[model samples]
Every structure is written in structure tokens, then in C-alpha cells.
Target: MLSTTVYKQLPVVSTTTCYQFVRLSSTLAAPQNTPLSHIPKPSKEDHHQDATFVEPKKSPFDVSTRIYTQQGIDGNDDARYLTKPTYPHPVFPTEECESVTVTHREPRTFGDKLSYNGIHIVRKLFDFVTGYADPSPANPKQYVGTRYEMTEGKWMTRCIFLESVAGVPGSVAGFIRHLHSLRMLKRDRAWIETLHDEAYNERMHLLTFIKIGKPSWFTRSIIYMGQGVFTNVFFFLYLLNPRYCHRFVGYLEEEAVRTYTHLLEELKEPGKLPNFQKMKIPTVAAQYWPELHEESSFRDLILRIRADEAKHREVNHTFANLKQKSDRNPFALKVEGLEEPQPNHGLKVMTPTGWERKDMQL
Candidate 1:
């Protein structure tokens, strides 16, 4: 029995030695037949070379070759070829990656005509208000050159005010949709929930800017007044013409995209503003967005916000299209074909299980 056990253990030990010998031979570039005792140990240079060996690029479809490659072995977790040791970078969609084409649906019915007219008038009103010139005292001359510039502080203040107004439409739309569903005894499983989600998302954006901008009491008061008035007007507009209301929100979002894009450009210009880089991302913004934690630059935050606005623009526009179709034929069913917006670009604001009221309260 003792001899039998020793014989069994000898084979296991021999197998382990053979594995090591093979690895060592590969590392040392030694002949396979070289005696184990005579095999030379690898030098530091040899180890370095082995560590940094670059595999030839193979065709992506060459699965047979790829199966033996480091990328294939690691699958999606492959990091051996990375120049720097770091987590995989998340690729946030830029303006270029997203569709820029705005959908324009011509009026095909009486309801469509009414909705279209309402949208047209409201759009004009929005433009008149937004386009009003309030020249900066510091850059009074900037207003003359087909270009106007505001300091970063001023721009952030503007964002705070705009976000406050921007959040109003989604909330109003959501509340009305909920009420409409309740009154009709039909569940709008699609639009109602989506509108609420949009409202929450826009509110979070408002809160994020509030923390970052830290507006004065006067600014806060202005936001309060604006929200109250805008909320009332939008609520009535939605009740009268839901399709038009959706289109109006879509237009607002398009303007928001342009505003954020402009802000990003300003932030990128060297010496455009002294404190652009100095400002750290707000904690709320960071918590909501994990990518911000890795790269908490203002530019990255702005880009993320812009991406959200772009999605909102698409959603509201699509909603308008659907509403138009519904209005034309009340019995018709509309399907939401738009892709679900990406999850705040992988940011977690509310807990996975439920939203915290305190975290969300404006």
C-alpha cells in the first residue's frame, strides 16, 4: 500500500514539473528536448520582453486565431494590451453619434391642424422670450460682433434658471397624463410612466445645476416665479392640445441641446474663464453619474447633460408624433418604437430598489 501511494504521488509531481518546464522553456526560448537540469533561467531582459510582447493584429473575424489571443482569453475584460493600467473607459455618445434630424409631421386632420397652430404660436412666444438681449456689462462690446460672450459664472447662472424652467414641462405633462388615464379608466402604461421618468430626470438636472451654480436668493426667487407661471401655462396648453404641448417641449429641448453645446465650447477655450477648471463637479452630479467620479471635469459633466437633453428632445418629439396619430383616430393604437433612453449614462441617483424622496425633493 505504501509503495502504491508513492507511485501515484510520483506521477502527479512529474506532471507539475513538466508543466513548469514547458512554461520555462517558452520563457527562455529553449529547445523542447533540453534537459531540465541544463535549461538556463530567463534573464531580466527576457522577462521584460515576454511581459511586453506585442501580438500581431489579426482580423476580427479570424475566430480560430483569436481563440488563442489574449483578447479572446479575457473576452470583454481584456486589458493586457492597454497602454495604461486603468478601468475600461466608458464611451458616452457625443453629438455626432446621435441623430440630429428633427421629425416634422405635417397636419393631416382637423385635430392635427389645431395642434400644429398651437405649437407654432407657442414656439414663437418661446423664441421671443429667449431671444431678448440682455447684454453683459463686462462684455458690452461683445453684443456688436454677431457674437455674445458671458463669463462662466453668468453662464452657470443662466443654466440654473433655464433648468428650473426646463423641468416644469415634464412634470406638468406627467401629471396631466396621469389624470387623463385615471379619468378615462385606461392605463397609459407607456406615456404616463415615461413622462414621469422624464420629469424626474429633468428635476435631477435642475438640482445638479443648483448645487453647482449656487445662485443667489434673488435668482432662486426668479426661478420660483418662473416655475409657477410656466407650470400653469404648460398645464393648460397640454390640456388643450397634448400633441402641441409635446412638440413645444421638444423644441425647448432642442434649444437646450444648443445651449449646452455652446457651453461646452466655451469651457474648452483656454483662458475663456479663470475658474472653469477650478470648479469641481457637484457631489449630487457625481453620485448620479459614476463616470463623473472617474473623470469629474466640468466638460465631461456638460457632455453627459447634453446627451440627456438630446435624448429628451428625441423622446418628446416622438411623443408628439404618437399623440398626433392618436388624435387623428382615437381608437388607433400607438406603439413606442423609440429606444429606451440610456440609464442616466450608468449613473445611479436613486437606489436600485426605490427612489429616496429626500434625494429627489427640489
Candidate 2:
């Protein structure tokens, strides 16, 4: 059934086409000799795409965050071993974490007032942008609706953004004090070490959360802008009056404690967040915090982090109250045979607001 129209349309046939034509001609001429079963069948494909692409079930940015997966432990030859904790994380007593109350130190001074109010504004703006509202009893907008609901993704977004900025104050303060120590050729009264440690701890918090949640590019861009602006501005402000900066950080940590506390409360509710039910501790996290194991719950991780914020809140408020130049960091070392209880690294003795200079031995 060779058509003149078919030859005219192609103009010239390829070697493959000529070979196919010859085979067809021979097969027709010798149909009986070559059994009909030997001939090839022209098949029609089902749901085949010649020139089209399929969409992904999930968006690229909405996928799970990257986590560490070791091929197999080769006698402790792990890359994470190279990096050590600058300051060891204090172990939290389960009872102590349960006893953790959302506490705040009322702003007494002009600087404290400003720091307190500023944190509120920043938190309000951030909450609005990230589609997060505190579901705590204290929040005015607490309701039962999809819009009011806080998903795992939303919580992660809030934590990632909060932790990203939280580390900045400590780093800036530590860096400045370090240079000041070198320039003055005098001791920083152990302030630099504590400040650096606080910053490092906050960074560890960020790292742990990132393993659980992946932020979109839009969220990442916000982090970049926020970090840059905050670091530069905080640096300049600290130069003028370091006290205000500490106070601001103290207030900021207070908010962090409040936020995490709310998260813990939500986690207690049954059937709200199913993802967290099966969530395991990330390897990086378990390695950093010795107490954490494969079986540790996500809530356990948050408790430790909340305790950390409480510690930072205590430390920063104490720093704000003390003489930045002369006062010794009380948390760095312990004094023996003190008549009254003093501030320590762990939650053994705590001042919710902060320790006043009058009470401190130094």
C-alpha cells in the first residue's frame, strides 16, 4: 500500500526507511513462507508523554530538611567529631523542666522599658508575617479554626527565625568584649567567655531545629536580611551602651521562653501534630546533648531549649544590671560557703527576673 503522497511528503527517505520498506515488501511477497506470527505489532502506549513534564507532588522548598546519614560508623571516624561544643550544654532534670514557668523580669529602668517594648513590636511583626499566633491562654486570638491552628511547619518557621536572631546578640557582645579586652590590655572579668558560650548555645538550638524543618527560600531571604540588619545595628548600639543591648537580649530570651512554653502545651494535646509523634532525635543533636538518645521525644528537646532560654534570660538580665567593665560573670565560677543561694549554670538556683548586683558576691 505505498502511496505517492507519502513519498512526495518525505521527498527523500532515509536508509532506515528504505530497509523497512524492503522488509515490508518481502514479508508481503512471502507471507506463507514467513509465518504471520513472526511479524512485529505496532503498539499504542497508555499514558505516555512524548514532550511534556510531570509536576512534583511537593514543592522543592516544601520538602524535608536535610539530615545527616552516616553510611556506617567506621570506628568513630565521623566528621562531626572534629567540631566540639564551645560550651557544654547543661543537663536538664526532667522535674526541673516540668517546673519551668513562663517568667518575665519587669523593666525597671528606661533602657529596660525600651528593650521590653521593642521586643513586643518585633514579635508582633514576625508573628504576623509568619502566620503564627500564640495559642497560649494569654493570647487574645486563641480560637479553634484552621486559621488559628499552628502546624509543625509553622512552628518550625517561628523557631528557625527566632533562633537565627537569638544567636546574634551574644556573638556581637562577645566579639566586642574580646576586642575591648585586647585593646585595654585588661581582663574582661569572664564576660567574653560567657557571652561567646551563650551565642554558641543559641546557634546549636538553630542547628537542631533545622534538622527537623526545612524553610522556604522566602523565609531564608528574610533570615538573611534580618540577621544582617540586627548584627550591624546591635554592634553600633552595644558600643554606645552595652547595658541596653543586654537588656534587649534578656527581653528577647523571655519571649523565646514564652514561645517554646506554648509549643510544649500544644504538643500535649492529642491528635494535633501527628508528625512529631514519630519524630526521632537527630544524630547531631543527640551527639551535642549527651543525655538525648534515639528514643527521646521532640518535647524533651524543646524542654532543654526552653531551659536554655531561661538561662540566657537570667544571664543577660544579670549582665544588664552589673558593671560591664568591672563586675565578674557570676555564672562562670562558684563561690564556696555562700550564706544565700547564688546563680549557677544549672537550674539549682534561679532568679526569674535576674540577679541584682547587691545579691551577687562580686
Q: lDDT of all predictions, in order shown?
A: 0.56, 0.79
Flag regions of model 2 displaced more than 4 Å. 1-82, 136-141
lDDT of 1 by residue, 1-362 (tens): 99999999999999999999989887777456656747766778655434332232243332111111222212322234433212222345444323332234455567556655765665465434333234454754455444234554456666776777777877788788778778888766456656666676676677666554445555666667777887888888788878667766766776677677666756776777545554555555666654566237667777777766766766665556553323222112332453422223232211121121222211
**Candidate 1 ranges with C-alpha deviation above 4 Å:** 1-148, 324-362
- In angstroms, the error of model 2 at 137 is 1.9
Error of model 1, residue 69, in angstroms: 48
- State TM-scores per candidate: 0.55, 0.80
lDDT (C-alpha) at residue 56 in model 1: 28
Whose TM-score is greatest here?
Answer: 2
**Count of clashing residue pairs in every prediction:** 0, 0
| lDDT measured at residue 339 in model 1 versus the true structure, 0 to 100 | 48
- Model 2, 1-362: lDDT tens per residue? 36977876674567669989999997777345456756755433312211111111155555322221221111122345547676877887888877778888887978889988988899899888777776646764375575556777678788999999999999999999999989999998888889999999999898877666656677798999999999999999999999988999988998999989888888887877656654666666776776787568788888888988999999999999999888899998999999998889988689978899999999
* Model 2 score (lDDT): 0.79
